[model samples]
Target: MVSFIGMIKRNMLVYLKDRQAVIFSMITPIIVFVLYILFLRGTFVDALEKYLESAKGLIDEKDIDVFANMLLLSGVIGSSVITVSYSSLVTIVADRQAKIDYDISATPVTRVKIIVCYLIAAFINSFLISAILLTGGLIIVSLLGNTYLSFINVLALYGITLLGSLSATTILMILVLFFKTTNSAGAFQGLLCAAVGFIIGAYIPISQFITPIQTICNLFPGSHITALYRNVLLNGVIENMNSSMNGLDNGSLATTLKEVFSLNLNMFDNYIMVNGMLWYVIVIIIVALIAIAILFNKLYKRK
Candidate 1:
């Protein structure tokens, strides 16, 4: 146990030694947040009006803003997953390439501990990174004077994003343990961050996608985490509401006779808090198991 603790500390210290390590995981989110605020300004209302027109409804403008906020928050939380996954992968690959991983295995370390060390180090980094990003995001919202920020909501956002980061760690470990080459690891991480990270509506709003694409987007862990953020920050809860014709267009009788039936929207209620936490636990266990398995296999390697 002492050795395990020592290994975790050592790995964390080593990770801190790299300047880029801190920037990607820690600095990049803030940079993205600033960029988003700048780019989305003066256009949010225009965009909302367009979405309202497409919804084919007489819904309240505030309701539209509320829904839009949820989508944006989800993207914000998704960005954290990118940072956690890529930065950890890069460090793990670097350690292996330098033969430090083999050196550690030569000691009295067990396979479980070897993997645990990396996870511990990653978790510590995740906690700090998630906390900072969440706080910064809330601050940005508050500064805009257009949104509310409460402690409970902030904590929920943190929990959801942390789970996403934990789940993403599994992919990072799998890449590092098997790829074994630093260049391959770097390239793979780059592709994932581009394809799976910022583009997948994790950093951008998934609501931008049509229904079919949005359905597919739900599969990504980052999407769910971002949903949690929206529920907490914007809705103050996650509820599962059945599809209702509440927001449907109610035009003049002549228009109504046209029989332009509107699509039913499924309303997810305050159940987001419960379901989101459930997802967090499930993702954590599954990712932990995968990371453990990979670490054990690598630990016993004869090289």
Candidate 2:
């Protein structure tokens, strides 16, 4: 047990000491937030205005800014989870290419312990980075939208972020295990950073896509993670806005907005509730972690 802990500590130190890895891990989320503020924010706000105008006084224009910020903040958090997990993968791949794993294998460490160390370190790094991004996101939302997040909401955010990070880390660990060279892993990581936002519906609302495209996005675990985050982060603002519009049907507005923004995922003509999605992600994380451990054990025995 002590050796397991020591391995985790060593992996974390190696990862954290690399300046390039830390900075690159953050670049994707930073760019997404900047682009959303500069361009996409206005576009979403304008669409809300147009939609509300058609509603004929059913909704207020003042609420649009708050809603847009909430949506973008949710996307930013989602992007952070993917980027940070992949960044941790870079370290693992580096170690493998440098034959650090070979040296570790020569030691007394069990293969399962070594694999668990990597998984634990990846989860820790991903969760910590996601938490930092979430904090910055809440601050931006509060300052720009002039709204405060409730205590319950903050707790919910932390829970979802932790789960999302774990799920991402496990999935990336499995993917990285297949790569024999850092260059291949690095290339795949680059592609992932570029496409993950769109694949997870962070770049655009899932509802705007074709049915097939929406289906594809729904199949990805990150999309479900994004949905869970958006539901918690935006539900209050949406419900509050819905309440102010007295003539609107109770909960209708909130439901519609959630659907339009992909804050709720549709599966087989039914939307998966947030709790169900959380459980699904948890199951995936557990299964992936176990599978990777078994695979690594076999590889170690062969060696």
Best by lDDT: 2
Candidate 1, 1-303: lDDT as tens digits = 787888788777766777776665644455455655676423444654553454444444544454444444455556666566567656667777888877877877776777778877876776666677667756755654445446676666677666666766665566566666778876765566556544444344554455566555555555555555554554431111111224243423212211111111112311133464456547655865776686658544645
- The TM-score of predicted model 2 comes to 0.93
Could you tell me the TM-score of candidate 1?
0.73
Candidate 2, 95-160: lDDT as tens digits: 778878788888888777778788889889889978988897788678776454689989989988
Error of 2 at 81 (Å): 1.0
Candidate 1 Cα outliers beyond 4 Å, as residue runs:
26-31, 41-43, 51-74, 197-204, 210-212, 236-277, 280-288, 291-295, 298-303
Candidate 2, superposed: residue stretches over 4 Å from native: 54-62, 146-148, 300-303
- lDDT to native, each model: 0.56, 0.80
Model 2, position 218: C-alpha lDDT score: 82
User: RMSDs, each prediction?
Assistant: 6.9, 1.9
In angstroms, the error of model 1 at 212 is 4.6
Error of 2 at 219 (Å): 1.2
